[model samples]
Target: MRNWEDIGYLQIGTSRQRQAHAAFERLGILATLNAFGPVLAGTIPLNIDLPSSDLDLICEVPQLALADFQLLLRQHYGHLPRFSLQETMVRGCPSVVGGFEAEGFAWEVFGQPQPTRAQHAVRHLLVEYAVLEAGGEAWRQAVLTLKRQGLKTEPAFAQLLQLPGDPYAALLTLENLTSAELRQRLPPLRP
Candidate 1:
């Protein structure tokens, strides 16, 4: 696993980045994940994100203990506005999806079983790590810009960047492109 620096969390490109970092730090997301389980996935960890984008995260749990997980969320974030938690699944693994408002931003979390490739979270996490290692700031900038245009979801946003395939595949594809080329890359709107 890469250090926080290597993971690009220390980079502060925009106010949104600063807020996301501060919130994650104050909330002890990684610490919480460590206590309960592994972080199956996270979008903010990429270092470049839209101001309006909620932190997308997934954690592993003993099982899909939705009630217990909700208790934990309540313990840590009950005070947050618009807080809501429900039982769900991520790629067949029992899971919980929770949403809340904090620090003037929204946070969406999915807690699932021990991560596996079957989980979209796990696959996307791998791709995110790859992009961080190979794409650097250019990839981050390109992603952020694309996101600001209201193309917030993956694969679709990835497609617009013309990187290649879906989001995960596109990240893999984009990671290999030159930083200069990536910075200049323009996203297109389509199906």
Candidate 2:
């Protein structure tokens, strides 16, 4: 299983880079859900404004066979992005990819071999209902780890953090994802 830390380039942060990453991720999530069904377990994990490099989604996909999953993805997205899948350190896990494609957020997936363990431990910390409230420790750990491996964190995320009050608190203040529009995710609030 290859550790993301070993992948290295993940830490590179920039506005252009973050936008690419997010688009790739959105595609992956939509592809997976479209193929398999509703996600049984998953998290948006990150919402704060930073020059994000990749969007992260942690989920349990129990019923779908890998080949079928790939086929469905290809049909929907047209082709798979240039991504290399890595075997995870967790046993029984196959591989995860940091891939980019047109029309969606850049995404990374960690298919847990030991679903129970990863779900309870890493996923809990990364995807709890109050994930935004988890503070900077875990995120800092991820940032540092990626840096050690030569990756970059998004710059906008850092800029948001420097703002007064809780930077992401504004998100919590929203009653609905769409205050008026039927299907729209708002732009990140300026601090």
Candidate 3:
């Protein structure tokens, strides 16, 4: 099995050329995930240009009460950053859990009210550690469905793979871009 550190480094190296403080974030996220169960572990729709300093996360704790989850946080990591619970208009009709900022990045949570038919199907695809950790057909189908819907899969995939967002976006964006073209457009990464 690949250690989180190795997977994390691979993600950083493949996504962006620059080395950033990723291991610290990785450890923090692992601690949170182990403590909180399966939840969103980082910022979504990451900035494609600049680096993000913190992990943004959320989860649907329908089976567990909000207070219970908060208790878990207090028991493990103490006070969390400021965030709110809200429901809002969203493309996927996402259920809002709350919004908060941690470290330097913002985190939001939404407990999806009731799963839509599409979501119902997507949610049961056997995600492990937030990734499609098995059942290749299910994973592929889910990815295609999300892609056709014009949803963001790359970020989710990165989280599952334990990679940072900026680098992930960088690699995805650069796949079709030539080296010269990329260098001409994006600033050089300082070592």
Question: Which predicted model would earn the best lDDT?
Answer: 1
Q: What is the per-residue lDDT of model 2 for residues 1-191, given as tens digits with 9 covering 90 to 100?
A: 21321212223544544554455455545455543232222222333224333444444445345555444444554455754454444434553333443454445554443343344324333222232333334544443454445433332223323323542333233322232331133224332
**lDDT, candidate 2, at 110:** 44
What is the clash count for each candidate, in the order shown? 1, 28, 9
TM-score against native, each model: 0.66, 0.39, 0.34
Error of 1 at 23 (Å): 2.2
> Worst lDDT window (10 residues) for model 3?
120-129
**In candidate 3, what are the lDDT values of residues 1-191, reduced to their tens digit?**
32322224334442432222343363364465443333333312121223432333444443345456555445444455674554454446534455555545544433433432123212322122223333243544544454455545554344333445663443343334444553344332222
* Collision count of model 1: 1
Q: Which portions of model 2 miss their true places by more than 4 Å?
A: 1-44, 48-52, 78-89, 96-98, 112-191
